[model samples]
Structures are given as C-alpha cells and as structure tokens.
Target: MPLALRDAFIDLEQYERLCAAAGEGERLEYLDGEVVRMMVGGSTAHHALTRRLDGLIADRLAPGGPCAVFRETMRLEAGTARFYPDVFVACGAGVAPDAETRGVPGATVILEVLSPSTERYDRGRKWLRYQSLPDLRHFALVAQDQCRIEAFHRQAAGWHYELLVGPDAVLRLEAVGVELRLGEVYAVLPALAAGADDRPAQAAFTPAQVASIAAMRGLPVSGEIEALLAELEPDACAAAVAALVAGDGVGGWAAILPERLHARLNARPDDASERG
Candidate 1:
C-alpha cells in the first residue's frame, strides 16, 4: 500500500513518538512543525546504490568500532531543524538520546543521494542549513543518475572539496577514519565504460564567478568587488576558476567555505603579488 500524505504537526517530542511507532514501516520527516510523508519508493538504481554504500560502511564498523553507521531513519540536527540523511557515520556512541530519538550533534559525516527533484535543495538551502552544525565533519553528495560524487571536508578554518572522477578513485573519509574506493560505492550498479580521463571536465572559477564566491564568503552583493575578492584569495579563486574551467562549478566548493575566511585570504594574495 502507498503511504498517505497528510500535513501532520508534531514537535520534537511528538515526532519522536510517531517515528518510533512507525518503526521501519513508512517514511516520514518533520517539516514546519508537521510530519510529512516522504516518498517511500525510490528508484531501483537509488535503492541499489544506497544499500551497497550503506552495507559497505556498516560492515566496516561492526564491532568495537570507532563509529556507528546508520541508514535512512536516523535524524540529524541542523540548527532548529532536523534532517534525515540517506546515510551517516557518527563518531560517538550516543547518537540518539534514546532508541526513539534522532541524534543531536551526532553525525560526523552525512550523505545525500541526489536526484532531479532534490539536486537543487541538497546543494543550496539544505546545504546551507547543514553548515550550521559544528559536529558535522563532511558532506557527501551522491549523484544517483551519474557516475559522480562530491565530498566536502570541514577544516579548522573552513571546508574543502574533493571530486571523485570515476569508479576507480579512492575516496578517503579522514573524518571517520575510513577509505572507500569508487568501485565499492557504485557497486551493483550498471557498468560505466567511462574512466577518470573520459569523465567530464573539472569545475573552474572565472572572473565572472567572483560574485558567487564572494556571496559564499558573505561579501557585499557586487560583481567587481567580488571578482577582486576572488583575486585576493588566489588559491580559492584558483579553485573556483578550476571548477569553472572543469565545468562543475555547482559542486560543493563554494558553499563549504566560510565567508569571513575569504577576507583573511585576500591578504595572502595581495602580499604574494606585492613581493613579485
């Protein structure tokens, strides 16, 4: 039977009880003080890949492990809101307050399986919200239809991005002390003839991209100044340029970086060029 769609209101307490009662039966999420039913049936490809990835990580953290691997039902806190990540790895033992409660400042890593309907929100609004969490160490955006994945690692200052080109690139999860090859992640899915070299070009940032980068940096809304700011942080600007050049600008690089750091980075670029 298909799940029913109803605008059901539940606070954090009530949501806990409801989720516990449902068990593994139907899918629900807390949105605007209401429990909204999520699409229980995902695409075959999505489920296949999700299961494979989940199994691989869980198998790794079986007994006396450093972390706990959880699937769809585990809720992670982001500001006042709660998000149900597709897969997550929590470094600590007490992710949930109890068996019935979702985690609070729990997950070290969060994964989002991207689809056409969710690609924008996952990258934009939701991504912004996730940034507010201090415990979150990394965010992995998995492309459901394509042979691509983007991982963002939170550094002391800000965040950095890594792109896994093909099914051969080894992805390292330093935050969770694990490493996964692209093959393991994409296993059981259809074969991809494309290798790293045959994959699409990398993303790069250009002068035009400065505004977006500056906005991410929390700079004022101006293109020229933003471009100048980008020039100021040549490394960051170079990263953006590289992403634009590679054609994957929409990847996580821009969002992962904090706005204030860009201001500090501006000094380095200016100091270097002044010496030359």
Candidate 2:
C-alpha cells in the first residue's frame, strides 16, 4: 500500500503568529500554510528600482492624500490564502491592523518584484487571485533582471495592460496619480541585452511560437507585454531593451537577453487604458 502524504496547509491565524514570531529583519509569507522564506539577498538593481518607485510615489502623495504605501510583509488575503507583495498602494489608509484583517477591499495598486524562481507563479496564479478583488485599480510587475514593468488597470469591462521599458519610457501611474521614467527606475542597474519572446527568430513565429504566445497569455503575466510590443517603433524597442538590460539586480544578463529582445520587438501595445 502507498503511504499517504500529509497535506501542508497553514490557516490564517497561525500564519500571522509565525510571521510575528520571526520578528524584525527576517521576511516571510504564508503559502498553503507553509512559511515560505523570501529572497533576502535582494538584488541591488531590485532595491534601486524599488527605491525610485517609493520616492516618486511618496513625492506625488506628499500633497496630502489619503492613500498609503506599504512595503514587504503587510499581509494580504485572497480567499483563504495570504501573501506578501514587494509593495502595495492602499487607498484611504491601507489594510487592516493585523493578519486577521482581510485587507482593503478597495486596494488601489499592488506591486510585485519579479525574481526568476517566483516569476511563473507571480505572473500566473498570483495575478489571477488578485483580479478577484473588487477595488484593485492597478497591478504592476517589475522585472529585476530587466528594465521592464507591466501595469494592469481594472476597467469597466475588464482589465487592461500598460508596458513601460527603458529609462526614457514614461511610466504613468495615473491610478495613483504619479508618473516615472523607466530610466529613473533603472538608474543604477547595469546594461544587458533585451529579452526576446520565446519564438522563432525569422519569418515571424512558427506554430510552436504561436502556442507559446497563447500560453503566455493564459497566465496572469502583465497584458502590457503585448501592448508595448504592438506599439514598438524602432526607437521605442531600442529604448525598452536598453531599460530592461540596464538592471543589475537580474544578474543573468547573457541568459535572458535573447528572450527580452523578442519580447520587446514582436509584442503589440495595448490602447484600452483605464477605460477598458
């Protein structure tokens, strides 16, 4: 007879206490009741980009606004699960006092910093879960290895995407009343080759490329990848690639260049905006 495997699951209450027990300095999040350790040796590129975002948003909000910016470890719940994102912009004060608090039903924006290990989940399952929230205005995914950002805004009909790359690319956080240049976000990272969408190089993409493209769409990855690529003029693609490759946090510059290159070139830009 096969031995039964124990199911791993941590309820919300226990998840909260475990996090509290770990205390300051250590970062942790709950996933299926498991105390998953977060990447602590944050890439310098990641930190630099995040700092720029913080400064820009904080500055924008300085004019006395009700929104609050919360960074890493302020727990958020979706259904019965809980998660900690890199940063979150909460309107009118933010999440409740404790883990027990279900989070702001009207969350304005939630941001996640992409790491290779978490990329799939971050773009896939996590995004789908986030979309369930009624008041989620925008969802931003920042790539640490590449100078890229994909922002999704909830629209009256559905969600839409906004892609911003390169230092020159302007990132307008209209949902939060702020805008940042891609260059500013990647000001401190190193230069790298842009990533390419995983597709055939010439004669457009083959059937396989088409399938892969479809697969990428099914995942919760920023719809902006498509949006940005569609509108990419020669200058825009060059700028986007430059911005993505500039990040030092990614570290795998050589490895991801081809993919980044493809992504920047072939994808289409989205025009739906916040009105979609």
TM-score of each model, paired residue for residue: 0.65, 0.62
Model 2 per-residue lDDT tens digits across residues 158-261: 55556666556776767778777766666656452232323322211222222233343332224543443454444444333332323311322222123544
Model 1: per-residue Cα lDDT over 1-276, one tens digit each:
113245565577876677668746466666457565555547887777778778888776647866887777667766566667788887765554444465555678888877656554566546666767777888888876556677887776467777675777876778777787876677666564244335553332244444454354343443334444444443455455334323323333333234654444444433332211
Poorly placed runs, candidate 2 (over 4 Å) = 1-7, 31-35, 93-106, 190-276
lDDT of 2: 0.55
- In candidate 1 the C-alpha lDDT for residue 262 amounts to 45
Return the TM-score for candidate 1, rounded to 2 decimals.
0.65
Error of 2 at 209 (Å): 12
Error of 1 at 201 (Å): 6.1
lDDT of each: 0.61, 0.55
Residue 270 Cα positional deviation in candidate 2, in Å, after optimal superposition = 32
- In model 1, how large is the Cα lDDT of residue 247? 32
